[model samples]
Target: MEIKEVKQRKEIIEPLLEVWQKSVRSTHHFLNEKEIVMISQYVPSAFENIPHFIVGYDEQKPIAFMGIDGERIEMLFIDPICQGQGIEKN
Candidate 1:
């Protein structure tokens, strides 16, 4: 797998959203659509001219993603279809 850092939301946010929804589906009784909308809305403003996203892909298809905020890991999600493959272990 090739790990890449993507800075543009237009390029990365959709995949992030896909994983985010799947991860939260079972636990959240009612998914907050507005929260996701807010995230998409504020991502551009939240960017700090640094690498905030790490995407792991098998060739061209993304398998896992992580959101890094400085030294803190803010979000991590591995595609449900590809879990248990150590994709998110890193």
Candidate 2:
């Protein structure tokens, strides 16, 4: 797996959303659609002057993603299939 900073909500959101929703539903048994949409809409601005939005990929496919909000981590999600691989620690 490789990690990089992602810009452009339009480019990163769909993959992030897919992984996030799947992971959440499988693990937490709940769907936070409104929160997900808010995050999708807020991520770009959330990183306006910050470093990269950490995104993890495997075999060129997006596998995990995280957003930084100031000094805190606002969101993190890895593909449900990839959970035990320590992708989130990246």
Candidate 3:
């Protein structure tokens, strides 16, 4: 996998949104389908304004990503299919 820093939100947001949704479904049991859908509506704005964003690509497409604000990690998601492969463990 190749890790990349994203300079344009548009270049990464759509693919990473799919990653975020699947990752949330795999682990965020507190959220129902309706809540998840509702929350996703704000994702684009957040991604666009986040201080930093990066993605992990597996040869062809983005499979994982993280959003950072200053020193804090604001968002992190890994495609459920790629979870546990330690794609971001380092």
Question: How far is each candidate from the true structure, as Cα RMSD in Å?
Answer: 3.5, 3.5, 1.1
The models' CA-based lDDT, in order, is: 0.66, 0.71, 0.88
TM-score of each: 0.63, 0.70, 0.93
Better of 2 and 3 by lDDT: 3
Off by over 4 Å in 3: none
Of the two candidates 2 and 3, the one with more favorable TM-score, higher being better, is: 3
Off by over 4 Å in 2: 30-52
Candidate 3 lDDT (Cα, 0 to 1): 0.88
**lDDT of model 3 at position 88:** 81
The predicted structure with the larger TM-score, 1 or 2, is 2
- Prediction 1 global C-alpha lDDT: 0.66
Error of 2 at 6 (Å): 0.8
- Which numbered prediction scores highest in lDDT against the true structure? 3
12-53: candidate 1 lDDT, tens digit per residue: 556566666665553454658676556555543443333588
- The order of the candidates by TM-score, greatest first, is 3, 2, 1
- lDDT for 51 in candidate 3 is 85
Candidate 3, position 6, lDDT: 85
Error of 3 at 35 (Å): 0.1
